[model samples]
Target: MTENRRFLLRRRPDGDPVRDDFELVSAPVPSPPPGGFVMRNHYCSIDPAMRGWMDDEPSYMPPIALDDPVRATTVGVVHASDNDDYAVGQWVMGLNAIEEYSVVTPGHFTAPVDVEAVDSPTRFLTAMGAVSLTAYFGMTDVAKPKAGETLCVTGAAGAVGSVVGQIGKIHGCRVIGIAGGAEKCRRLTEDYSFDVAIDYRGKDIEELRAEIAQAAPDGLDMVFENVGSPIMEAEVFNLATHARIVLCGLISEYNAEERVGLRNLWQLIVHQATIHGFLIADYAPRFPEGGAKIMEWVREGKLRIDEDVQEGIENSYDTFMRLFSGANEGKQILKLP
Candidate 1:
């Protein structure tokens, strides 16, 4: 454990990334520069966004440079520090990477996490982390869901999606969740208390549209879009008048070799709908407020957050692939050994 083990990007991926696209290299643990600290990353977040970061494209965040450890949100303890703001042994979470150690300077993305404030230290990466915050701000501030309105959330069984659905219910909206499998759909209705759950697995665009239309007979009032392409295309066709669409993540197209344009763009014009692309980073200043409100909901048993934690940094590739393969159970996390 003396040498820091890093899962580094060696080459850009053509499509769905393969193991050869990355290299697990052992290097000397990075030292903190002036006004910085080094953290021994204990948990690494595995998200669909990681795929987009691998591509050399203009995005909200810069693409992961070649030969560098893949960027990720990590929760770890301060192993060494050169800053008075962050002392050694303090637990912190922020934008780091999939490496044994990370050199961090306190900023908008970096913050000390009160480990005792939550049930587990990893909660900072799950329920109280960016996942829930994304759901909170996206649902409340962006989508602006209203009572009696029909709210449809794609990838509803996911970490953010699940929370979004519950928030919709709390706001008195009729929640319709579209997930991948029978189990996930069942959980959407039973575990998350969604009004209706549509299983999108094994369904074509037409079939999925039929199911969605059936679920929301009057059309959808608000759409929290996570998966893109076919799912988005279907959701667009079923928009209610003056609908608000929160464009969160396009997970489906993240690893696609060729992107397909949505055929139902005109539906938005016809419905006079508004689609707002949302990024959690935009609300960085209010993370504390959002986190507090979300934790309150969790304590009240109004929200249920799940995390799928995999062991060993060596399993990073397989763990990350779960986001694409639909193998992950919940918020995907990688626990360092």
Candidate 2:
């Protein structure tokens, strides 16, 4: 129990992240330094964004250096602490590794969790967490969608995409969700209240585009694109004049062996459309407002959220792969014993 278990990046992944890309290793758990704490993690977040961080190239966040423990946000109970602010057994969330134990500095990567305000602890890592924040800001600030407009969301059955679609409905836009399979497409329309849904799996680019075009016969006023691939081309081909595309994620092409250029660039010019990419961290100062609104919607029964949780740190590697293969149902997370 006193030893620390960690998954270190063995090398920079080329295409898909394979199990061998990480090496499980152990070390004696270290005591917290001055103004720091040692935590026994209960859960670790597995995000698609983590894949982008695995590469050696520069990004909005730093890449994981070789041999360093893979970085992930975790919720844990304090096992020990040198900081006066955090007592032993205090619940906290912080940027920790996918390890059983972690030594975290107080401010830079750690924060105390507010358990009383939420329905459950894991909710902090779900609807009330980073995924929802990303959805909120991306839809509100950048897309800036209005009532009666047609909004199409890619990856709509997953965490962030589901949230975006619901928020679009709340704003009075007609929401269409594009998912990989028939079941997810049904969930979007039935469970998430998306007006329509399209299944992109087993369909070629042309076929998928036809489905997207059919779903949005009035043309797309805004696109909350989560799975960026040929789906982007399909969505682009259907853009209305002056449409806004919120580039939240590119899950489809994250691990592609070859980078394929989106051939619909000319459509942007033809439609006078605009696409913008954003980082959720850029809206850190507005977390209180955004978090409050999302929570309010949850309490009012206006938002629907789900999580795909796998037990144990041992399942971490396989659980992470589920995101790429579209095997996970919702927000993917790992629970540690």
What lDDT score is found at residue 314 in candidate 2?
72
- Candidate achieving the largest lDDT: 1
Model 1: residues with Cα > 4 Å off, grouped in runs: none
**lDDT to native, each model:** 0.92, 0.88
* Candidate 2 weakest lDDT stretch, 10 residues: 106-115
Clashes of each: 0, 0
Query: On residues 1-337, what C-alpha lDDT tens digit does candidate 2 reach at each position?
Result: 8688887898989898888999888899889988888999998889998999899877988998999888998998999999889999999988888999988887654778788888778887887678998999999999997999999999899999999999999999999898888899889988999999888878888997788788888789999988887888989999999999988888877898777767788999999999898788878778768888999999899998888999877777898999987889889999988
lDDT string for model 1 (1-337, tens) is 5799999999999998999999999999888989999999999989889999999999888999999999999999999999998998999898999999998888879989898889898889888889999999999999888899999999999988999999999999999999998999889998999999988888899998998899898999999999987988888889999999999988888887788867789999999999998999989899889999989998999888889999999999999999988888889999996
Off by over 4 Å in 2: none
The TM-score between candidate 1 and the true structure equals: 0.98
lDDT for residue 29 in candidate 1, whole number 0-100: 83
- For candidate 2, what is the TM-score? 0.96
Look at candidate 1 and tell me the lDDT of residue 325. Answer: 85
